[model samples]
Target: MALLDKLTSGSSTPPDTSGMSKQAKLVCELVADFNSNNLLTQIRNNNRSKSDIDKTYKYPDHFTSELIETKNFKMELLKWKNSHNPYVVLQFHGGGYVGAFKTQYRMFAGLYSELGKGASVLSIDYRVAPENPYPAALNDALYAYDWLLNHGYSENHIILAGDSAGGGLAMALCHYLTDRDRILPAGIVAMSPWTDLTASGSSYTENFEIDPLFGNTNESLIYNSVYPGNHDLTDPYISPLFGDFTGFPPMLIQVGSNEMLLSDSILVAEKAKSQGVKVRLSIYENMFHVFQMGMTLMPESKKAWVEVSKFLEQMMVL
Candidate 1:
């Protein structure tokens, strides 16, 4: 309770991280001093053009990316040579449904190469909200999946992955496929997913100031508002936590204990397990939202991806 109060009140006193590794403790301290909410606000107001945003970053050299443009949408294929398996990951990069970063896609490609047995990733530049809300992203994700299927990838050879909002999108896509009786992917990997658009999770309030990325529930809610349009916030399409997962594929969800979205991942994992879905949930101690963003730099990030790879391998064996 003292640690909770210390964090919630923004006290300079550090929390009792006795059990955390030195690196994890350092990360916690660094994030505690950061003003992530202010950064989020600035990004929301920047209004930068796509080209301008694209100019800020580039894909990493570990993988090669090829642009595939369509009449309605564009996608990129992140390929690594000498892959160990035949798996295709359809990635939905997270940006609160308003924007995405090229750097994140490159990191995803790195994840695929390291933990996924050199699996190729198809990163979709799905439509975002406010400008393109609700069904637009859903439609684009479905189209990308169909493209994969039509291009010779069997349903069993494919896996779905996403971070934050994209994680929710991946799950929604699975829900859509199940409802319509389509074949499901082999498995799904969600990293710090925002499963509840209604912002009903307890961590929203309890972990507000403690969460280094989101900072508070309202910040997440602002992003949520632009996407739902007139749709019900609790609609299973928007909040997959409310949906039934009777026949869903095996899933692995990773979230940081200090994140405001912690409860979102917890509740969804419970829901999936109740409906007989194979679910693996990892809660990293002393970490923040989407801590995997640090990737190779953070030990927790490396461990998370290793778990993801193990999960993928297990699913493939089933």
Candidate 2:
């Protein structure tokens, strides 16, 4: 059955992990009660610097990630031999604008590369906030896109993608490039994008109790301080949901049903569709944030990736 159908099936199960794989249920149970306040505190104090990107991240054994350095940050470019147009996914890693999980992003890039049937993946280490603050990440994203363009990758052959804050950055990058008349990517793929920094979405209150992450907690508020670094929560770049998507590229957004950020993804899809952008959204039933990152045994994760593969194929054809 289609993922969207799972949501619309109207089943009235009361369990939070309904429709989740047993493995996904376990994963959700682990984090549903957890909060990242301590972790954020450590990062804020610089006790947990993103040094893990170099020493801690393990690349998938299937491919080698080429390290490319810009003036300010390093990027991992995982190239695959495409069977069709030479395509690339310029990706961003999510850590709520403060955390850096290069290894996780590398693994995600591996999926994009494989699912894309040889499309290359270029994942960047954009500067995060509290240490780097707003606009820093966006600036680096722009540079990464430009690097691809300069290296012979056409805008239409490139896609912007990321999860969590990185996902929001992907959308915001389109806004920046679009406003400046820079070339936009062929499409966008966001997994539980935090597009609304304002935290104003109704989901914040609706899913507050059930969300496995950031549920009924102040963890997101900490990010507000360390990331946005200002009171301008509604800024289009800060919160891309407020940005115009009149001419943006096709977008594929996948979000878990129980995520507090569910509204973030849904609102963006509605806006994009209203503006005539082709959008495909899959709200996995009772799943949590970025459930695609869960263990491989999870059926939802695999299906979500299959959806990604399908989207990439369609983009190439277009």
Candidate 3:
């Protein structure tokens, strides 16, 4: 198949990338080659252990790293200089509810600190599935939030962000908060979030053969692991694409035009808008899932983080 035909196939409209950065396109090709081993699937089927997913990036030495112990888990806190009302971004790492703590997450914490004005960052090493299932991670996230409040950080100081499964978790945390009539956070940032575990989105199949990490395979390796002894797939706390956004905070959602979860971000953006929530949605041309992780390596990724900065500034001002 010609390159143009491959570009136009099953992606969102226009599919035009004649003007796209050469580096962005290069990363796409590199990603395809890198994922040829099906690393994610190997982890899902227990062919690989969770320890294999704990890759870390070499981040700045200025930020302090601490393990905040809770009765159930240890939360990682990455912070620049500490001060009263210091900007805080509570993050969750994505691994399809299985993968955790990747190189990109550390990069994001550093980026958030620089962009968010010396922001303090926190990430929960939430429990994963085939071991600890539904409500476990969600419960851990709730504990993290309450832990912040009890320690004197206002809800206004926090902006939740995540990528892929972690992105869905960020939104689901808000759904959990709103339902309980708790104070909501400052905002949310999601990158190629997997909002529907059922793989109900048209893009799930439309982009199947093209999605570098998740194309044309048994999706059972996904939600089946996170929600094995399950409730309904559409349950707001699990899928979050079916979640409530009324009274939710401002949001920034970014997705790749080429990812299978493209529809996940689009659907949630529309839902949040309908419910009168503030929303900013951007779809990058000819990219892959969680491509923002490559911000250190690609212009498109850097561009997406710039959008995140603008949104964070706007949220802080409001």
- Candidate 2 clashes between residue pairs 3 or more apart in a chain or in different chains: 129-133
* Model 3 residue 62 lDDT score: 59
**lDDT digits (tens) for residues 1-318 of candidate 2:** 132233223543322334667888888887753444566544554633364456545544545667877898888888753335488998888778877655656668877877676788898888876678887888998899989999989999999888988889999999998899987899999999999877788888899889867776665542345677764888888899999999999999999989889999999999999999999988889888888786244667766776787788888853
Q: Give the TM-score (vs. native) of candidate 1.
A: 0.85
RMSD of each: 7.7, 5.4, 7.0
Measured by TM-score, the strongest candidate is: 2
Please count the clashing residue pairs in each candidate, in the order shown.
0, 1, 1
Question: Which is the better candidate, 2 or 3, if ranked by lDDT?
Answer: 2
Per-model lDDT: 0.76, 0.78, 0.75
Q: What is the lDDT of residue 307 in candidate 3?
A: 75
> Against the true structure, what is each candidate's TM-score?
0.85, 0.87, 0.86
- 10 residues in a row with least lDDT, candidate 3: 1-10
Off by over 4 Å in 2: 1-18, 33-48, 56-62, 81-85
Best-fitting candidate, scored by lDDT: 2
- Residue 72 CA displacement from its true place in model 3, Å: 2.1
